[model samples]
Target: MSDMPATPLLDTVDTPADLRTLKPAELRQLADELRQETISAVGSTGGHLGSGLGVVELTVAIHYVFNTPDDKLVWDVGHQCYPHKILTGRRSRIRTLRQGGGLSGFTKRSESEYDPFGAAHSSTSISAALGFAIANKLSDKPGKGIAVIGDGSMSAGMAYEAMNNAEAAGNRLVVILNDNDMSIAPPVGGLSAYLARMVSSSEYLGLREFAKKTIRKLSKRAHNAAAKAEEYARGMATGGTLFEELGFYYVGPIDGHNLEHLIPVLENVRDSEHGPILVHVVTKKGKGYAPAEAAADKYHGVQKFDVITGAQDKAPPGPPSYQNVFGETLAKLAETDARIVAITAAMPSGTGVDKFAQKHPERAFDVGIAEQHAVTFAAGLAAQGMRPFCAIYSTFLQRAYDQVVHDVAIQNLPVRFAIDRAGLVGADGATHAGSFDVTYLATLPNFVVMAAADEAELAHMTYTAAEHDSGPIAVRYPRGNGTGVPLPAVPQKLEIGKGRVVREGKTVAILSLGTRLGEALKAADALEAKGLSTTVADLRFAKPLDEALIRRLLTTHEVAVSVEEGAIGGLGAHVLTLASDEGLIDAGLKLRTMRLPDTFQDQDSPQKQYDEAGLNAEHIVDTVLKALRWNEASATGGGARA
Candidate 1:
């Protein structure tokens, strides 16, 4: 409440309809108020700040000019949606963002009609926008599709893939290239801005559309020459060489912060009947806020912060984050292994590859927003005898699945996958959850999948993957700080297809995978209090599972339970298959599996998510208790335990 800014102008804006009422001149004040409100809201909630700050004017301009809901305004990645959210009647709940039972950090279609298509991942906006545009065209609906994509997102092949089919949408699709943080931020307020408005205005668009249709009718040779000439001419005139070559009517390099420039150009684009137009609007990543502007990353994502000083609230002092440990360990490992190389898809810092990059910049590759490329590039490196660790988030790895299967797993190439953010990532919810990586990767024939029980286990798995050059190996670890375990002086390579037993007991055995092992230990203590002997084993490898350990535990123990921080058909499913195949379960052994529920879990604390998923200690104890009773009844050949 204290951090909430006094947004008098912004208070007047309840929706895009309300925003549309104000005169064009009044929008500057409104944008300033919106910027302050956005900063205040994010400062209190601690979500995406810098990206929203950068798009204040652009958000104000888009909603003001276009008739939203009717006009599909799709935000690419949704990182900058805070400002848009505030303008679109979600301001009251703005500060509740990323909290338990709160608004999502990214755009969710269910949240509001304003969010036409849900987006958390980058580069899908243009494609979604085209879908909306074509659907509208077919339905004879009275609206167009507008996608606001950032420059960083332009690196993905999907954006170009959308642009290639843009002509078919015809005067219905509008893409606003939000070039906020490009390497070369376009020069502000010059002849380029004036020319952009002139070229993109309603009066000029009719002629431009006619020329586009006329060009399509040309011969291949004539079309190539004409297209090349048009590309260079537009590039010189409006700074859109690449987009023009991709069949988009390019217009911009306009200053996004300049509301006067932004509003008019957007108004022209909205009113025009020209299809598949891309307006490149250049803006700063963190504008207006002094501290954000000064920071290198413009406070892209942040913890709760002081609005005045922009000083973010720091977490309590604890062990280093799993990311930092991964980076440091990889850097250390690279010192001895010259064959080790690192690759990330536009997320060197997020994946902790930046640490390795600092030590071995020559060997590290930050393939920008191109996960498909990153996977294949790593596969190529592995094929040439170099060990390439494709450090990517588990959620992002979904984009390169085909490449992982065809290039790495199918070929049996030894490309190492250092998957960060392995399980229920807080705030980001199901969209960013790393729950399916085990099921997806482990199911592949030559793929070896592993999840870290803790920070120390993560190191051992890292060493193991580097040492083994057999096939594609993926080691998954969760987000946030580690469990402060003492690290070995040097990482050790463990025997594959083997699991270590944490505690030995005869009555009930709890088999654990990934971070769930800690909870399994807690459940063991609880089970012990009830006079039940529980053995806890950390099943480190999800694929090539420790079959001997599984058979031993199931045969010796009356009841066996498998726990994991993954969806169904993951570690537990694999264990069940092995147990059934081995015929060890024929002796009336009660078996149970614990995993995340079938439904998609929403945004909540990691602990709450695990609790809801029945992967926590209490659930584990409950599961074991139920299994124990069932085992007793089955063993006696008739009556219940009680």
Candidate 2:
């Protein structure tokens, strides 16, 4: 229906099997068409673009060579799976990427038989592929587990762990190292491609092995010298001894974008009897598209854009995002508090620490994708009396819970956890949601967990965390733009373990935590119009529970409702537990806890997600009405709990 690019080669094929029928040169043309289609699809939908562009030829090569569906192909992080998704018969739903009830942006097992594994997080592909490879081996299944991992993913300690354990899979595992950034070059195309094949040859493998054994028999000094020389020689040519030492038959450093190079290397690796091989295919991120290639971060993720000029649609100017609020606030605080420092796990920009890094470069640490290390590093800094703010996404913090419990909380160090994306993030979906931080952090002893209801509150809590040097404190805020609430000139230190009543009334008390405070106010307004008196309280601290405030509300109000933008174990559960423990329920208080449902929600609009979670104003009103009616029925002896 649209002026789509003529993809004759691509149109002829719906699956990877169709790719095998095309001529080798035609395959290159198909890759060009696929790249155009990918760019167009992402232009229409605005998902991950740079990553998929970077791996165009590699994806084509793998799918063309390997028998997928039978042979498991796992893409690390799944950001680059768009091209793979298109080739695997998911081309029809490419435009609905990250949308409600559409195809997922990532590879999903439920979406296609071609997707044997699902991935949204980084560095999990190697481990998953190893599992698939080993399981197939144990069951005598005729298939290979091929893992396409990136150089960036290698920075994580988990990738190293998987490589250490890769020997168990024998020759059943195939790891294609999709390296876009590294020291690589060798006189244009064909000659460099030849070196890749030579490095993988049996002659080289035998000679390298022979040299290693021969050198070991020499005198200690000569042995060390010879070993160093051999390593240097191999490193100069192949740059794969590290992988070889880890027990993988290293096979590459090929031109990932060149079909001439990519096809042969991939076919060689596919047919080889070797198990656990690493094919290092060099590529360029955001290849092809001029605008993406020219920009920094390579326009990694984008919004809907004009295809001809490559100008993306910019969001309307509004309040600063919650992430920038945290970053700028932390930076402002760091100016006075000389001890303050910021740490992020490979997400300096993603977590907004880049703003802090700009002014206080010496104080900002980008610890690269190791969340465990980032948490413990912050703890170590805190131990020495340095104020360290460990800025990590709520979902990513799950990776370092052991460190949070052992290193920071157990030691009672004041490592401030600045958690961004604290609620249902829209497009990135359930895997990236910050739904469990309140529940997890509140459960820890000596931990002060606070969720900011607005941008100004975030500033205040940031100040509070800086002043409180007692124990580990965490402040969580959501993903999007702030509520346009005017920021304070200098943040005032909030009273710990306390809450403020925004509106005062007699009949119904609505206790809200985090970003749901606005919805609570709306619900109150709706109730007020219906002649029901409603009171609203912003419970600033999820940990301290605001016991006095909660007790008074519980005793005075006819119905008490707890609401949070987190999962079931969070604010509502804590309030109910507190009310039960204090014996406040003896007054026949009608209590209701509203939270996200038990199941993980799919990617949808933020408003839609909150509605589904029953945290919206309408749901709040419905919940309050239901509680009041239940209380009235009990009073009349018509219905009562056992």
Candidate 3:
């Protein structure tokens, strides 16, 4: 271990104050070292590697310039905060990132004092920093508040809302716009155009300053005329008239990676005592690492990899990821249907739309981090007689709930939503978990909601959603690899408002939904050993609950349990709705609904979380036995089997 290379200068930093102690020259070295550490850490653990590597210098400069913990720094999305975490007393624990009981992948107020406002979602930092600024003003505090947001995040309406409010309020807030020219993938929309304008306006800045000085020397009337002329010229040149109109003191198109340039620029901004300012810093997404720089988006989020070659370890030779399955299925479907188009909110690769985009470039749409736009845009496509498959993560789909209700559902449009990450996402924690989509989407009128038991079912649901032309339909699937079931060669529509019994038994029935059916199967096997036979039923769709099959189970079985990988108001709640309406209590049937408890699950392994939530095989078996009053009889020496 002593023969090992010295720990990076970043590893030496335990807080911002420690970073402040470093010489400006040392910070350059620190940045290089931090970049290496971040690359290595992410290679080992698998996470948002590219974004963090990109921000090493910026992270160092901010910590060195600002009085953190006292002076709040909010990072939008926080995916790029790995270097921030390393600097802020988490260097050692960086190896355990996204693991059970490890440091979070994003900023967490509870995790560190340096992280003033927690964030995982985009377009929230400005709002959060403005809140801190307002609080500071109210409390008579003297520290500055900064929000580091990406150009990608700025595309969202919320970022504009915060910028609008911050500018209007005339608050002491500094918005560091980290313009990396990407958001997981290449960015989209008018904001991208605005950033392009800023990048190309370097010469215009000098001209504007010259014009300003020249205008001051002119007569009063000439000056007024020149001013209007200058405003028009500046607007045409810089394309920042929009931001200026928003009342922010827009600064820079600065080089974010250059320590010499960034340090002084940040120092100037820190001391200027201006109203809300937007400092646009243009940096490469994966600046230091050669592999990441070459394939920035691919390295944006990576699995464990070889640090030397930056080659990710081969996944254990087994089943394919659900994403791959979705991609293959979508590609197969799109080959036949010219009207079938795919849309994603800056997650083409993650959501498996990359294949669709590659195969059918004309039909595939990547709408950037604008989930709301993606939804309405799909609605537009649907209205135009095109079948739009709006694929988005369940958590992100929450951003466009109103659009789902109004633009799609209310209009009875045939916009199919391929909701990915539809359960507890293991490492990214509560913020990224797809816990509420089922409950939320199920409640919407004219919306059909379904969950896949496995990859085959997912393919079938995709087909069903595509063929169903009546209204909006959503099919949700989980994060990891699918069960090793052979996918169908051709897509087929399943009967709506239906479910299937996977295993037939008597005495107890387990009604499982989503990918949790596998665990339910395992539980069924364990219960079989205990002589308590279980009937395992997969309720495919959540919205149109198979009441007939459910009622049949309740009538025949001694006890019934509803299981789903979601929160309270999901499948369990829907079952309870049926139970209440049919007066199952009056019928003297024992019913237990097993779903995720109403609490934010902490950072842990997905399997660990499942076990903790009593959704694992052993726990499911235990729950069944307990519900059957087997434990009570065993305790009373009634000769119950162990």
Clashing pairs in 1: 171-274, 171-275
Error of 1 at 282 (Å): 0.3
For model 2, residues 1-642, the per-residue Cα lDDT tens digits are 384678988998899999888889898889999999999998888889888999999989888889987999999989899999999998988889999988888888889998899888889999999999999999999899999998888889999999999999977899988887653432246766887777666566567678778878888899879866865675677678888789887766788888888777777676666557888888888899988888838378888887788899999999999999999999999999899999998898888899999999999999888999999999999999999999999999999999999998899999999999998999888889999999999999999999999999999999999998999999999999999999999999998899999999998899999889999999999888666789999999999889999989999988989988888788888888888998878768899998888878889889888877888999998898777663433443223322
46 Cα displacement, candidate 3 (Å)? 2.3
lDDT of 3 by residue, 145-185 (tens): 79999988877989888888885334468888898884222
Off by over 4 Å in 1: 183-185, 207-231, 630-640
TM-score of each: 0.96, 0.94, 0.91
Q: How far is candidate 3 from the true structure (C-alpha RMSD, Å)?
A: 4.7
lDDT of 3 at 467: 92
Q: Model 1, residue 290: displacement in angstroms? A: 1.2
Model 1, 1-642: lDDT tens digits are 665678887888899999888988898899889998888888888898888899898888888888898999999999889999888889889989998888999999899999989999999999999999999899999889999999899999999999998889987999989887763448557676788888888777777667767988989788778767866987886677777777777888888888878777887887777657888888888899989889947498999998988899999999878888888899999999999999999888888999999999999999899999999999999999999999999999999999999999989999999999998998889889988899999899988888888999888999999988988899999999899898777999988878999999988899999988889999999877766878999989998999888888988888889988888899888988887887756767789998888988899888888878888899998887776553443434322354
Model 3 clash pairs are none
Top-TM-score structure, candidate number: 1
